[model samples]
Target: MTRPAAPSQFDDPWQAQVFALTVALSDAGHFPWTDWAQAFGATLKRHGANRALDGGADYFNAWLETLESLLEQRGLAGQAEARTIRAAWEQAYLSTPHGQPVKLPA
Candidate 1:
């Protein structure tokens, strides 16, 4: 039987969240949209050189990478902090029961 679809436009919740965050940051003038576009395009090109991009996780992963890099360069967040946050999210995701909203541990 086919699985039920998620109530989201993107394939994964994280994808949607990241997309929104990027747009919000751009809207807030944290970075120029043109810069974001150029950086994202470069990231896509580098990732695509390794293998095919299915416009799913691969696309979002590249998007996330570009955002992280931009934030790092702007001194908003460093790589170590990003890795720590990522690890926390991963742990939260893994610990949450299936079909329930994941929340970071207090």
Candidate 2:
């Protein structure tokens, strides 16, 4: 019998996008990769306390959280702004018609 293919590194496009963004930020000298690894590890530990991380949404959520916290610590972006943007995206996603692109307000 043929073996099944290995799963993709990310379950969703957003996860991949976040991963790329993190790498880009680190490469740009915003912070060192070691710092990113440390923060991401801590976030995983904290979030993993409640549930199993399947390297899917749960993992990426923790990753996104770590990135956001790091950015805030470095004075790059505020948590409030992140929340606002998330809310806006959520609203846009909910209001948009199925099979259409979701657009955020200017």
Q: Assess every candidate by TM-score.
A: 0.75, 0.78
Please report the candidate that would top TM-score against the real structure. 2
Tens-digit per-residue lDDT, 34-99, candidate 2: 999899999999988987777668889999889989999999999999999989999999999999
On lDDT, the leading prediction is 1
Against the unseen true structure, what C-alpha lDDT does each candidate score?
0.91, 0.89
Candidate 1 deviant stretches above 4 angstroms: 1-8, 89-106
lDDT of 1: 0.91
